[model samples]
Target: MERRNCVVTFLRVLLLVLMASVETTALYGVKLKKKEHRNAYATMMYMGTPRDYEFYVATRVLIKSLVKLQVDADLVVIASLDVPLRWVRALEEEDGAKVVRVENINNPYKGQRYFNKRFKLTLNKLYAWSLVDYERVVMLDADNLFLQKTDELFQCGQFCAVFINPCIFHTGLFVLQPSREVFKDMIHSLETGRENPDGADQGFMGVYFPDLLDQPMFHPPVNGSNLDGQYRLPMGYQMDASYYYLRLRWRVPCGPNSVITFPGALWLKPWYWWSWPVLPLGIQWHETRRQTLGYAAEMPIVIIQSIIFLGIIVMTHVARPGISKLCYRSSDKTTSLIHTALKFIAIWSILAAYLVPFAIIPRTIHPLLGWALYFLGSVALLSIAINSFLLPAIQVFVPLIGVFGSLLVMAYPWYPNGVVRALVVFGYAFCYAPIAWSSVVKVLARLHVSLEREQFLKLVESSAPSGFNKLF
Candidate 1:
């Protein structure tokens, strides 16, 4: 009994010693972590847009790419309080971003009818100053494409931003030294009616930092010391997409050509598939998305749509012969009216075939894949209307061919300048207009013959034609 008691006591003591060692080790790890100052690469997200998923995907791509680059900084997102919880969770769990939710900053300069609706909530960007946990933060816009790691931007002073415009600094990407005091002062400034010429963050910021345009250029120190004052960023950090389109190459002579920003028309943003054919640099954005964030989130919807479209195509093919058996001939006036109605329906359906797929597909998909899917889906839909109505296939598909030709013309790589590209596209359109009109005329003529009384009787027979014919 004594020996057994002694052994049990020994085991208890050993277990206590093991627990102590574990606690000690944990404490040491925490201390080690504390020794490293945490800086952050931050992006902001707000609610209210049909394109939320695309922008969410964009943020993920940005955060995930930064993580993949192994930048010595935390990935952060300053999301508005109203941003969906699911999106916040994805940013945190999937993209490894530490999301800081803040109330939307009310824009004092809102309510003008002509104001761009997109910038209504943009004043919320002021919340970036409130991210005090990080010593420094690089606030980013979702449209930016980071070509390589830009860790050196973290070393910049109180504020730094790229001057993509000659006289105005672009806010698409900027560095900030997080300070609560600065945030509060900015809020006060807003309430006091600070002169915001354009009534958006971009304009307000331009006014607030009036001298940034004249500030000395930023240069990261070799010794790795943090900077302390505002400085102008080199053009390479925010190379405009227009610059590339003009020259078909990057010609920014100074600074590391580190980032590309699309500050053009919202429709022309890099994520849109159509943007790529017009601005070739968009392919690079899609490539980054493919490599980093991927289209996994978008794939299921794309596949479902493809399958539905395919089923429509197959069903149409099966019903073509049955549909043809129904067409025979009727009265001259009745047949003419029916022909007009059929023509209208055929044209409307063809238009829908091209447009509906373009609307429904995920907008952020790669240009080649998106365009191909659109074409396939459209052809499938067009076949149904053409076969069902006995419309001329060649004439009906003319618009589709014209659209393809337009894309080819817009995307031609050898144009010397944007002017030449525009002129060529205009010329193509001018040349194609007659062909399109001729196709329409041919289609109308074909309908006149095809919709004779016997064919009309046959057309209605399968789908209860006697009642339909009686109405005429």
Candidate 2:
């Protein structure tokens, strides 16, 4: 009994010691982190929703620029739960950003006609000042482009921003200290409805820092800008995207601005790739997204698959029997065989083309949509292939095989998510069913006739109305 008691005592003591060491280590790490951020600052941005994830791509570009300039600051992404976990991980692990998840405070007047499309969570911008760990921070809108590192802005006072328009300061970029008092003050103003005239965060901030543009200049700029001189940022710090075109009109390339803000009024931004004349910097945003970790990883697999499938199709078409037989044959044998093969290949080629946008475009908007589309698209392609090329008897097992493979891929440790897995299965079946039906009909129609490609084509063409031949 005494021995057992001693063992118990020893175990308890060991556990206590381990606990104490862990606590000490954790506390020490916190201290080091605080010390690191004491004099340093952070570059911050807010994004929420899949549509807004479009802006996250732009944010990645800004982060890369800051990294290249070797700016002395932390990169912070403040987001809501609407953003996907994969995106959070990408920003945290790949881009070296500290992601803070916060509940979005929606606008109280959501039903107002003018307030329909704007994010009520714009109020969340006030949270920046509450991040007390950082001595100062520069908050940016996701639409801004970083032409050069503006790290020097950290030296300015609490409310430094640009005066791009005559009446109000632009919130596309601004510097401020994190303080609970200021945060509460802004929150109070919001609750009381003392918002900016424009009804966005820009207007709210402009109301709060009304004198920023005309304040007297400080003797020796406390932060980077003259604190009293309306905290005006240098003209080169932020430029309008239109300025790029204006420069081009004169056939000039060089510009004085260090950063470019998109046309805020028109809601036109670089990522809308379909824009006419393709905004000069649209390609730059796409390249940045492709270079980003999660997005980049998906592209090579798609491109390789597309190329392989296309190669097989081209080779098959080229190696088929010579054109003379197809052109001169009185009997429909050659035409039938060629048409059957062409029809099969055509279906798959069109599906592949339809899936290309889903691969790259959906991914930029939301990882879940990207993943759902990819898995479903794969199932659709596989279904069409089996139904078209294989014998009717063997088609029954194709979906089962596809389901098993899809489940395995989803179950793998790297891509595991119960919700995503369920979605993939639903999407897979939804996309595959209709194509499978059409294939079954085609197979049945051919069953009463010859199974050989040549006979099948002849049979189909013989049934067509007379005028169809002249059109061909």
Candidate 3:
């Protein structure tokens, strides 16, 4: 009996030891989960602007690229409360992002005269400081194109930024340790009417961190511990996209050539198809997006639009001879009012052919598809004008040819430098300006000649059915 009791006790003790070991393993796993999420790459999003969708697409691409590169950090977005639920869910479920929704920060500088609409809501970017749950946050703008994993940036000091300009640090990408104290202090500064020149986040942050330019460059510690205090980052971190236009390649000689920011014209962003060929670096960003986030959302609409535009072109060409034969009728009467009306309609039709694509092309479609559709849509609209008004094809397509020629001139790769490239573009436009102007003049003169011809074409008061306008 004594031996049996001793064996039973040994078994009970072994069972307890196994249970304790299991519990310890589970607790360690929980700790690992917390450690994995302590650092984040964050950006901000707010609604109520025309470029919201465009920026949202950019933001999605940026986060997904980081995820694709396997950065050892959580992806987060500081979206405003009004942002759509679908967008938030997409970010969470589709892209693996943690979104912190907050109220839009009031911009005290909004009432000031000459404030740019582009910077109106940028003050909301200051919310990065409020993310106290993160040990470090790399705040970013959507226009930033990461060339590689910048995970080393998380090892920098409490506040670190790159000086894209000689003296001014760019807010396009910055590293900060999230703290409630600093966030509240920023709010206090804004409420107290801080000296914000230009009334933009760049200007406000510039004034806020006036001494960052004097700080030493950031160096990640060999021991792999985070540092404290402000530090200046090398231009390599935020190499301005314009710098590439001058030398045709990245020549920034400091830090890691890890990121590029488009700080030039707002309309010439990397995502727009028209910005490509003019801005060569845009293709690189699109390539990154293509690999990580396929163009499924915008591709269907792009395909449908292309098909419709092509069909219109074919139908217009087939009916051209018939349209002229059926619609033309000799008449002896002409009036100043009638001639002027016809001339006006002819000019408007050509202008619409050139301008309508900007309205219909999907804003976030792949750049290649966008450019193709722009061309097809223009041609389709021009064909309609040609078939309807009997205008010369050369005169109708002059603007299209001129614009394409100018783009080619600007995009020519053999320019000695950007200045010479600029002059070449200017010269092309200066010479071609007259041709464009004369195209309109020639079209009006043709209208006058049509009225005096041996067989004058009948006015728009034709017997054709009203179904003619249903092509759209």
Candidate 4:
């Protein structure tokens, strides 16, 4: 009886252990599924200015495209206290769209310099929102227009955050799964301004999610040879007016029939009204609000002034005989011309040298400083021109003299590359040459004469004292 009891007891103990193991395994699977489901909601955030009518129109187009894709999603519009709520209200009227207006928080670091504080505030808000119910969200700048539906982004799952590579992290386009941990980390990262602060969000992710660097979830999309990132999106998406019109030629037209987002770099926007023909009529009308009335009115006036000033300078030099005689008698024309030419060469050499450092040094910080120095040198040249024209005897030789001074100063023994050093020398010379030429021309033009032999003798004879013989 005792032996039978022992066998039965052993069997019961084994059965209990097996049951507990099965229950634990089932619980683990359930927990994993629950975690996966938490990241299922599709969401996108847009921050825009209240007065931006063009941006509003673009947002509508984006919403229409998203609806057409049949993806269940929400669009959140972030606005500040200064912006009217009507903008958000107008967007929410669209079917299946929700616009949330968040008040801008005061940040001193932002806008103290040339930085835009609004963007940083919106980023902070997005970080806070991540702690809420949504599983996944996309942060898009207000100017983004969707060419096609991007619902496949959800497939990247919780482990991956989708964004464009080779771009600044703050570029305002990214896909992330919402988590309290990430939210806390992002907040800390923003507060400290450190990429990987001790226990901060972005930094923590960089360390924990090192895999992200290699398996970046979304390589920026490509369609028919078109690249699709926030910046490189098709012409139908947000086209930067600065990069398009001012910086580069616009090869494609931006219009409504095709979707285009407008990021409000107003000073840099397309000034030509004709460029809008590629857009839908309604969108064209919307974009017109972005046109600066002051800039448009001033452009013609500015062109007229420039033309008049140039004509005055040219006519003054070409029309005066007395001026030519004075120049020929007082200054050695050959030496003056040679000096002018040498000054040109010297300025050009310096400019070339300045650009060499920019090309060879990978860090932008030093190059930016170099640009500031170049700009200051240009300003000095302008000052010399004004002084030479206004005060003829001021001996406006500073620019010519400064050329060699700058070259000697920039040629440090530390930079040993001959090509780089040569470029730097050329850059300084290039920059100073224009200033020197401008000053010389201004002085010559103010003297009031063309170098003609017949007109020179007539002017000298007329100026000779009464009854005095004129010397040829």
Model 3, 318-361: lDDT tens per residue?
77645544433433354677667766776687789888997888
Highest lDDT scorer: 3
Clashes of each: 11, 13, 0, 38
- Per-residue lDDT tens digits of candidate 1, residues 334-398? 64566677667766887798889878888988898888888888989988877766777889899
| Model 1 poorest 10 in a row by lDDT | 26-35
- Full-model lDDT for every candidate: 0.74, 0.54, 0.74, 0.41
Give the candidate number with the greatest TM-score.
Answer: 3
RMSD of each: 9.8, 15.9, 10.3, 19.7
User: By TM-score, highest first, what's the ranking?
Assistant: 3, 1, 2, 4
Model 1 local distance difference test score: 0.74
Using all chains and alpha carbons, the TM-scores for the candidates as numbered come to 0.79, 0.53, 0.80, 0.36
- Expressed as tens digits, the lDDT of each residue in 1-472 for candidate 2 is 9999999999999999999975543222112222344433333344544466556676776666556556677777666656778877877787777776656655654555576455566766766776677777778777666656666666655666656656666666667777767776776677787855656677678778877656532124445543344433332244564333212111111235656667544334765543211233444555554554335544666566556555644553442232212332444444667656655564454356346545454334323334444544554444433333332433433444454455454444442544565577577777777766775566545443444556645643654445554434
lDDT of residue 181 for candidate 1: 75
Descending-lDDT candidate ranking:
3, 1, 2, 4
Model 2 regions lying over 4 Å from their true place: 1-35, 38-52, 196-198, 217-236, 244-255, 264-268, 275-277, 286-295, 300-472
Give me the displacement of residue 112 in model 3, in angstroms. 1.4
Q: Report the Cα lDDT for candidate 3.
A: 0.74
- Model 1 ranges off by over 4 Å: 1-38, 217-220, 223-236, 243-255, 324-339, 412-427, 454-472
